[model samples]
Target: IRQTFPSAYFIELTVRQAHYAIESTERLPPAHLITWVLPDYIQFPFLGGGSNGFSIGVIPFAIIILALVLAPSRKLFSFLALYLIPLGFTLSIPPFSWINNYLPPFSHMRGNLRWMVSAAFPLACLAAASIETFIEKGIAGREKIMRRTARGVAVFVIVLVFVTLASQFLAPRLIGNEDFMGKLVDFHFRGRTATLPASHYLEVAESAVRDIGNQLSFANAWWVIAILMWVGAGGFFYFIARWRPTSKTVLMLIAGAMTVNVFAVFSYQYHNFIPQEIMLQTPALVNFLKDHEPNPRRYRIMGFLIGDGMFREVLVHSPMPPQELANMERELLVNNTSVFWEIQRMDGLEPYRTLRHNQLLNTLINADKAGYIFDRENPNVRALTLDRVDNRDALRSVTPQEKIKDFLLQLPLLSMMNVKYIYSLYPLQDPRLTPITIPRPASIPVNIYLYKNTQVLPRIYFAERPLFSKNQGTEFLLEIAEVNDFRHTTVIECNDCVARPVGRGQPPKFVINEYRDGLLSVNTETTADEWLVFSESAMPGWVATVDGVPAKIYTANYLFQAIQVPPGKHQIEWRYEDIFMQKQKALLEYLEKLFR
Candidate 1:
């Protein structure tokens, strides 16, 4: 595991724990993660207002709980222990969070809420076992009154589950009526007489009424079918209990019914499915980028599309039809769609990012917040909360506004990183960004404009002046933040390297012989020894060779790769050889040859 995921292990052992310590001072107590494992209605009385749509449902959870109390077994207890241990770490409640604070692996973890999912399997097993136990012990050999009570409880619980499911389906629509809207408005603005114009409220109420009416009209038939299924299941269970007290068929029927019931309720609530073509089709913006930029891998694009307040406004207030709204939502270039379109992007919702890259991003975000590069009143710029900006959560929480704002402040940094193009829902009012005129497709919503960065640097360049830093830390960031001309100067993190005076010199002529995943070859001709900086992430597992002789790769610009090259023509090659990947490839080849 350590060999396969060295970076992950390193982060868990060192970097992540340190970050958690810093965050612990200001972190709020997390929401109850256990609530997600319970029934959906327990979190939200109805359906639509809840944060998550998934749950274990009332019937299964209740059955499990009842079993644990009434007919506890060693195996069930072991499963319960398995369920609770992970759940406890995920809870992260105040003083108890010490479990996460001091524990090696848990302390290093973020998104601990996901641990609740591990509880589901054990809970399911416990529920199934409990039902069997109830049938055999509670009903088969029990007294008349005890058997009657068990049967009655089962019937009642079944009825309650169906009622909850029905409410989950119906309540959201029913509550969207004009009366509810008026009450909600009044409650929200009890003292304020003119928080919003009366016309706005009237319009909202009318929209709600129309939406609810349409939804309820279509859902009435589904609701009837669901209710009948529930009744039929209840009747079947009652008959089975009376006729055959200890039959395995009873358990199977109940399990199947519950599964179908849950799926049906979920399907009914979340029925707005988008067509496959609409979802996977490349957007006009993406197509234009691909057509224009042949070497997309050389440069990255920043997209200001996700979680933009302007986009949200359009979604809420645009006069577009429902189908158009759905189309717009699905077809928009968002999240990791750049991967699908084979376009390199500056930001994405990836699970993990290198700590150095995250630090660079955070520094840029902090520079924006300090109002050093961007005007405070610039609508094109906004600040990100630094506490939330880290390697684990930075890209996940990035919105269009924050990214554009970061770009405004970190133009030099972006250029150094080879960020050449930016697409935004709002016009970026910056001199460095020149708006690109492209024919907008019908599917691409209005106001999403793409711009070319006039100051973007090349993928590979030479710098005679090398600014040395002892480490890539606060001092290094401060040094680079003051560097206005990245083209003429480069920052290299080294204790022994000599710092040269910042001077202008003719850059070495370099031709990229080949650039592809895992390998890059460049031929360069220089009159004097100089630093060749590659605008790519500097990380381990990548080795550099000058004319097939091993060369040292230095951390440059706080986030990129740089190597010292002597005068004269040289063939420089870099190969990323992850040991884990090499081993896997060898194993696969061996297997294939063996099979043959």
Candidate 2:
């Protein structure tokens, strides 16, 4: 892990700091995090209804409370539950907040609600122990009243479980009905019509209706199948209870109930399953992009789908149908779909990125937010538009004009990263970007416009002049972003390395001999010593060799690899190899040979 991510420690520290800051700003009330007995009313309305808005649900809460009251090992289980569940929540409170401030490892933890996940095991154990104790006590005792009460309690629990299962199966179908949805719309929109004009109100209402209907339709289907499941559970429970069943028979009944419960939940969760063939079907836009840029390694593409935080705020609140939203999310090459298309993409959903790369991206995003516009005529000079207003209000209002104004693509930084093609649902108004005509796919509701970055740099280039930066913070990132001639000037993050002036000579000729995953070879002939900058991310474990001799790799342009070369034809090879990878390769080879 250390070999793969040289800056892993730094990245972790930075991420922890960022996470803490975000958590501080978006801190939930202590009661919200600690209230495991109640269902989250804001998130799970259906479940929350049973708790009278105090907890998640009454059924689950009752079981937990019963376990606390009746468990044989109540003290130990209670201690574990109380300690684990509240540990994360208390970080936000006073005395415990000191742990977050002083303790480095503990401070790094985020997502306070996740602690409840760990507490689940103890809770489950407690509940099981309580139930077992109840049964054992009733069987061992001589009193008829106690035995009768235990049997009654057991029967009640069995009935409740089956009833809950039936509800799970039936609720999806009943809620999905059009009439029911209309009622829901009415309930939500009650007393709000007086604030808006008649036309606008109608538009909003229609959009809301469609959105809710689409969500229900997508979430649940196969009403007949659900009905069958409900009937099956009810019939099985009835037959089992009616007969004087043996121990084996009762066990089978319990096992069947467990299996059905699992099946119902799994089926409901994965109801949105599309066939493999349908999911992997290449979109027309992807085909177009592939045809134009045959070699994905040379350049990258970015899709302005509803993925970016700012962009999502505008599009999500724009009263779009849920189907349209789903199409945009699944169909667009936003996250990892670029991998399937065999095309390089800069923007992706990743757990963590290199500190420098993340900083550069954040800097560009901030610049766009601030309305910092780069000159179309001269790439070096940039202008800030103070007249630009914040789109927060516009997003809330959700007009077409406002939606368009919300996004200012960071074209300059994107160009530096070798981003050639940018596709978006809405057209971008940038002078530097030229629009390309492509027929929109019929399935897609919105029009997708492709823009060609005119100022995109080559994947590999030589720079005679080197701008050395002592600082590796936001200041350095800003300096890198402000560079006009990225191809001619390279920014090196090194305090000791000597800065070289721009040499007066013809540019060096270079040929990419070979390029593949984890390996790159290039032949270059330069008139003078210059820095060879590769647009690939400068990650750890990547070793460079100049004519079979080891050479140092320096970080360039805040995120790429840069190495110095003298005036001669040299074969430079870069291979990413780590101890863990080598061991895995050896193990695989051994296994293959042994099998043979």
Candidate 3:
């Protein structure tokens, strides 16, 4: 957080690891998709990548992109409107991302795809402008460019379809005689699981492709479809060529029929989207823990997917749930499958503490990742280590590595934070882990397993004294605390905590009075000064009042909340106040109301 980089959008916690924001292959051209329903996009929810992995905003995208190439005049405006603006947000390069890196709304953007989505309107307008210019004043020499362009577009699209259909017709013979699923299974992927077999989802998905077979075999119908598109384009252009009272009606009919054709082609693209909150299926373990007597302890899950925008229960410690993040990333990043985990929310996840809470959350993780954690940044993948000193900002690389070493290297800190369980897709055979036996659910393609740690402590505990350090980084704290039993002696540099009274007149007595999402009340009886620590992500908003008087809330254990209380019976209450989240919620509500 000390300085910013040009590629800040790529590494921003909220939008990082999100596939759609970083990858723009999905929005390339309509030529890539059989479904041609190109919807206009003005804001986030840019899940352009669809079942085809290239589906989002195809229609308008194709129109905008093609207009730039096909149209002659107003090229700079077209370039700025269609190319510069959209890419300025999506690309991390100098000339492209200049606006995003400098602009206020663009800075700390929720996702890059949202920027591209913003360009959609301007690009559409550019296309419209070109159409109007051509219809009214026509390009010099190429006066019939509009009519020619329409006919050319139809022929080009028909050829593209013919090529695509040809590929399907010959795929079986060229690739393999086996069924499509068989070929897919045999192909190796690029990341850690690349050697591992393809997910069953791939098989199930490829099986669902509408025209997987030789569309050429149905050549008669294919030709008819192509003819219809050509006729429609020809008729639209034909009417524009001459003004008449009937032209408007004829254009409307052609446009309506074309819309139906496009919709029919991609009818199934949107047949399967259910909002995550409404489609809640609580994890079995989550349900069990919620029902258990000792339900105060929080746990973390890690596996094939961590934070799904549609599934909130999967990730703890994060104010924004998986589904919530997904909705944001998919829309804003324009990648439906991408998930965002933004660690630096200006709106507080919790109350502001007596101490400043400006630190980013990524410094704590020790990820040995595969795909996104490319090896180029850290050449020796085995030696890829994340430390607070550097924030180990290597999580944005796209180069696929076979395996990421010790993705959960922060287990020591997590244990101290009261992470009781680890839900992982692969077996974590690390020394500190113990497998929790459970029937693997059929929902996920990979085998989902759970592991437990015996060393993790309770959510609330009394620490002997704060281990002071000049470096308040997460990795540094863990390194210092590991020497002693971290449960009793944790590290922090906050000046609010001092050692317990020398004589220790009497061990401090701790009792919980009341607890809620944003509030904690504790009754403490202590004859000696002691530090009372609560396991939770700390921020500036969490203030403490001991015996109805204000006290400093220390940033304890590198990431938790704590306050020192004097030797006496006292009621210590902590209240949470997050204005950012409030504003975000209010804005979201207003937006929903406006849209609704």
Candidate 4:
């Protein structure tokens, strides 16, 4: 069929046919295609046009532009060049970003946000120049309308600049105020430390950095994009106003294009947004500033000058675990010395050459068995800080008790620290404590009650009954003394005002019972029958037995129980199946009334 026409014309017609077919397949209306397609070829790359087609069209246009330029007035062309240079530079280059590194941390953003912020002012100036050029060109003539439309684009670019700037300021402020960051950081630090993972700090820092990045990208970036679209709309108006030469036509074209672009950008961002972490510092403080509505379960109290405090403060305040407890024992038993003091202690000792000894030292120091030796008055104490016990070199001649005692004596000033007594208790079965035998002293009285290996010495011991069913296996009598006078006492009280007796006889009633909300209530009448009343939440999981006899369970109207109190508390022992939540101690006569 193409034989009837010239070869070049036939080829052109075939290409046109193919192009129309593609345009139809894409559902583009003919009018839309006509407006978007170039006479040569300059389709958007992603939409199908490649660089070859784009260059073919651009080169011809460039040639024509040059021809027109040669014929134009020199002054007019210079003005145009002057206007274009600033426009191109402003759009492509960021000015303020050069100094962004030194800016205040007003937002939670880290790297790129700063760059965007610094560029905001320069971008605005560019937009202003473009808008000024468009207004001066006017929207009457078709050529003038196109110029105005181009100028309006400056408005959109400037608006975007402002939005980005605002985000730079707002993001940090918002990120700094979130509650989850603090809670998360607190959880990460405390949980990791409590578990005593050696690599905790590295893991935490990595996690924090990740969270900061996520927050910057997700929460703050979109606002900048939105502002950019508005400024872009003005630019569109300036161009359309010039292209069509009618005010109404320019307005409609610009409005429609702006709306579509803005909505498209917003929708794309919303759908394509990648999830990221928000970096936070002083999370707890930020949470408080937000009026504390995020979480209602925990009660929070802020002190007059100290800031917000809560029961959870215990967890936050002591993010570091009891390092003292772990360190003390590791040093005492594991011949491991302090890694911190390696340089100070081994400065000139050239006993070993291989790094093998150093590695061995590290392993021993980290383990649980290397015991330390210290001298009280000497500023420098000597012991194997990093060497483990030499099992092969053990002397069969030395008794275990003697070895234990030697270990105890090797520790620094135990008696002065009151930790020396820990030595007399020989052979503690638990991993945490070591035991040494204390010889019976003539002048000092000794009362020995062994607690089961599993039961830790609680901070508070109920004096009422130190013995519980859980005390089944082995026991040790806990020695109590007055902190001020060092006098031995039989009674102990927990900080919460609960009391118990531990000595040889019955502890005197520390406080008289008085009921305020209801009538007087008692578990079992104080009739010559001995019974002790206890507040209970439910059937106490563990029931104490005296001499293998189950004590009667008495329920109080207020959900308390009265157990039969053995007369004179003559060493009638009782034990519980479960551990007590708080320690009980005998309340001193003077202290009991004062507290009640």
Candidate 5:
């Protein structure tokens, strides 16, 4: 929004286009962030084309609607009208997007589909109100009216259960995509993360999922189990409603029913809580990257065809699959790229990523004398399906071939990230791989082969001079990244005139040394005016000091940190402390992700 929506007219046009495109989940408007909100590009027949919970077991939604219709009240009605109704219609359809486009958080909230959560939230209120209304009129002794609505609903539940059970006896619709195991298989297969098919996933120690049925098992199981749970909850609620159960019992009944409902929905999900060993035991490669302490050298390892899932695709999913989760852990364990490598999902783009790295990631790699320089013709954006809403210029334009080409381009550039061992099914004979040191035996029993790169750069090192650009856009930085000589010097384009030959900075004097705790300390001496850089993702809050005075930290070489120091012995410390985020909210936010 900051970039493209510079003017109200632009924001309005963008929103209007999105409104027109809201129905088409795959081709969402405002470009680039196609899969911003919804998990799936092709929206299903659920709300906003996709829904919050199991479609077959969504009794609460129906009950909420029914309650709203039967026991309407202005107080409750306001929430529906002011929040849920407008939110749903505006997000689902589009002229209403202006509210989202102009409003505070809404203005910045891309991923048009995320509004689905907002849509569900107000309905939840309505659902609660609906239940309360029923209690007040039928069950509560305070009301003069005496209606056996609960018992009636209980009878209705009995009929519904009977029909459901009867329906089960007949052939099911058998939509084989119950758990979408095949889709998982297809993702890994295409991404070249695993050596075997999805059937063989997490095979080590015999994952229970393998024995769930077979490689190709499941058919409408989501509905079958969901229906059973819904009936039980519905019957339980109905019984309590009919008996005019005490107020306390009513609360208990609702809580119990909701718990069962949630669990029933959970049953539809692929079983989690699998042993981590089941996922990690298969790859012996991680053993090589043991307890690697932080150092100036890059310890990062990026696997191309090494894991069993696609890194780019999995980021969109919350409570991501065990397969993808396992893959992500390995990305950190090996310090690899070519996957969604962020520690936590960013609400918006960070500065180093936006200004320095985004263009490099998108720029297509070319095998020039410069060895894997950026290709102007075909940008390496295969991995970046999400548009860089932070970049003023990065509108989403993905061509069919660019995806494949970009994926291919990333293979050679693994060395750029200091990857020691390269994993792939393709025969490894690239020019960049020529400098890598292969294992002595040079052969492994696994389906995939691993090659090592010897010329990999350290994840952290000092730069001689920054290849600065006055342009705010990253295009110049990307061109600099392509230059053979610009290896360590390609920081953000800057006007700072400090220049010198590349001299590696010494390890800081251990005055108070720390790393990755979001706090960095350095008590060291500098001989001359120079830059200190580290292989750390740059973001705000990295406050720096030179002899207890403030200093500037520049985002250099795209994905690292850089700071200039004068010729003098001085103590320098940098700490990434969030001013607003407290421990309780952060912990709660982390906990909330587990349910998803």
Candidate 6:
């Protein structure tokens, strides 16, 4: 919003985005780092279409491919058969559950190593079918050519794997040199401090390793079972060669595993390949409502999937429009996105004061207490899907419009799939209801009433535009309180306030929540105009002088003060020693004292 809606005084931020900013901040003055950070173009190990996870899985398959090509013509079919057996077994295993667990919904891509593994057999089949046909024709020269080609491909695969592994290790140092790993670690850690030293990249690496070890150990256990099947099947093939076992026997064992493994790999990698996403979940509900099998498109329209029994039966029996059937996937994506945006909007309001409660608003004015409202359990929005909403439950449900008046409130980005739909259907006007035009191709407008007054009347506007455009017939009006001198009161010690994932107001600082004895004690509120500042004990001049009269100040390795009192209302502020945040227990100690 700061970048796009510059005229608006409001600013917005997210925890992840804030961390990213901090990561980038270390290298500042873009021109200095621009030429060094990125080159004109990168070449090698095409990451264009594949997920990072899928690329990892391609290593073993590439080796198998080469082995198949080099094997003698007489043994080629057996080698090929052995190569494919694991895939079929993989297909039989439901791997999608694991994959879904590995991948969070907001993940950028769906392709992974399992996908590569899934494709391996099909490619192998193509190669074998071609090679088998060639050998039957007795193309003697072609055999040598194929063998050499296979070896080359295998070499390429090995090289790709080595390079990929190297890049993972080299990336931190290469990108940011001495500070790279620290920055990456800091970015991931967000505002949280580690128990160990912040300078230790090894700790960061160890933590990451631990996390991956846990997840992959679970995932690869299945791979191990699959490999055991490979060993058994491979041994059977080896024995058949010696004992003159029937070709049909060898073929069935190899072919069955080959076919089954695809599903297994797909399931394991994709988390069951059953499409457990929210968009797909509505089908069960739709089928329940229809009482007969609904078409695939009907499930799509319904926005999620239902279970297999009643829902599946209903979908099977109901008359589904061929076009709607075709577009089921698209609709599911949109509905889910809408649901996520609503969650974010609701979550955003909790950290800020609502104008509806004068006491809370006054608390904000004095800085004595900051009010926050937890509307409900907010959905963990990883990525927004494609969806349009005629209304949002979060915005309209509030009694007073002023509660939703903050323009900088939560707005999430909608998925690209939904944006395309909204943009294509521009000027989507419905006169029967208060029509708020949805300009984007993929997202629908959340027509929300933000504020109300007797004279101003209620009005509506779009909560978020999924697909942004320069010429979207949009103009913004910013309302800054005209009264420059907002009244406030001061307190000797004030600590209560709302703290959350803020983007760009100020870097987070420690606070003290002063309370006395068994009963809670301390200032209830502080005026916006007053400063409740804390200082390190090291600050020789740092002392609390209420009305310029010296008072005995408590210091926990730092001095603290509440200053600049206008008298109506004010809260205590804690100012840290300049170097407090950079090192040691200074900041932590300050918070401990305040909260104590």
Best by lDDT: 1
> Can you tell me which runs of candidate 2 are displaced by over 4 Å?
1-10, 13-67, 74-110, 116-120, 139-260, 308-326, 366-409, 497-503, 579-596
Give the per-residue lDDT of model 1 (tens digit) for 1-596. Answer: 64537755346323354445335332223323323333232222111322232245444544566567767788778877776665564555655467666665555556655555676676666666767766665633444533454565567546645655665576566555667677765764676543335656655554554443433332455535444553554455446546664557767766776776677657755645556777667677777888888877777876553444333447445346555665665445555567787887766542344555555554343322221222233343223322233422223233445555655777787787788987766677898889987666676466567889888888788865677888435446556766877876788888898765555356578999898987889999887778888877777767899999999999898778999888889999989988567667889999999999
Summing lDDT over every window of 10 consecutive residues in candidate 2, give the lowest-scoring window.
386-395
**Candidate number achieving the greatest TM-score relative to the actual structure:** 1
Q: Give lDDT for model 5.
A: 0.45
Name every residue pair that clashes in candidate 2.
38-55, 38-56, 39-55, 39-56, 39-57
- Number of clashing pairs per prediction, in order: 0, 5, 27, 76, 18, 94
lDDT score at residue 568, model 2, on the 0-100 scale: 86
Give me candidate 1's TM-score against the actual structure: 0.73
Error of 6 at 530 (Å): 47
Candidate 1 Cα lDDT to native: 0.61
Indicate the residue-level lDDT of 82 in model 6: 54
Write the number of the candidate with greater TM-score, choosing between 1 and 3.
1
The local lDDT score (0 to 100) that residue 583 gets in candidate 6 is: 29
For candidate 5, write residues 1-596 as lDDT tens digits: 43332333233222222332322233233322211221221122111332431122234444555557666787568766655544443444455565555554455344555555555556566667767775675434422222343444456556645644554443132223334545544543574444233444423212222222221123445434444553555555555545666877766766666665556545534364566654444233443333332332335544442222332233322235665465445433333222232222111122213423444443332111111233334464322322232221223333323433444445434444555555543345555554332232222222344555655555444465566655443454444445554344455535865456566465333344555557666666667666666556665546788878888877665555777777767666777755333344677898999776
TM-score of 3: 0.62
How do the candidates rank by lDDT, highest first? 1, 2, 3, 5, 4, 6
How many angstroms is residue 141 displaced in model 1 relative to the true structure, after the best TM-score fit?
5.9
Residue ranges of candidate 4 with Cα displaced over 4 Å:
1-98, 102-109, 115-129, 138-244, 270-596
Per-residue alpha-carbon lDDT of model 3 for 1-596, expressed as tens digits?
32243234224323222232222222333232233332221101111222222223322333344444556566537545564556544545656455544554454343454555565456446545544443344332242754565676577656756755675666555444335646554442323243223554244334333234443234545434544554555555544545432434543553465465556455533434447663244444444444542434344333322332123232222234445544433322222121132111121221121112212223224222333332233454234333212233444433322232434444665567566666544556677778777554344323456677767767677776566656533345335535435665766555443554445666778888777778888899988677788877665457689988999876666667777788889998988766455456789999999999
Model 4 quality (TM-score): 0.20
The lDDT of each candidate is 0.61, 0.56, 0.48, 0.30, 0.45, 0.29
Which residue ranges in model 3 land beyond 4 Å of their true spot? 1-84, 91-94, 102-105, 126-154, 165-231, 238-245, 274-278, 293-411, 428-436, 442-446, 472-484, 495-505, 579-596
Residues 326-408, model 6: lDDT tens digits: 23433323323323322111111222311211111121111111112212233521122101111011111222122222211
**TM-scores, one per candidate:** 0.73, 0.66, 0.62, 0.20, 0.55, 0.27
Candidates by TM-score, descending order: 1, 2, 3, 5, 6, 4
**In candidate 4, what residue range of length 10 has the lowest lDDT sum?**
472-481
Candidate 2: lDDT of 246? 51
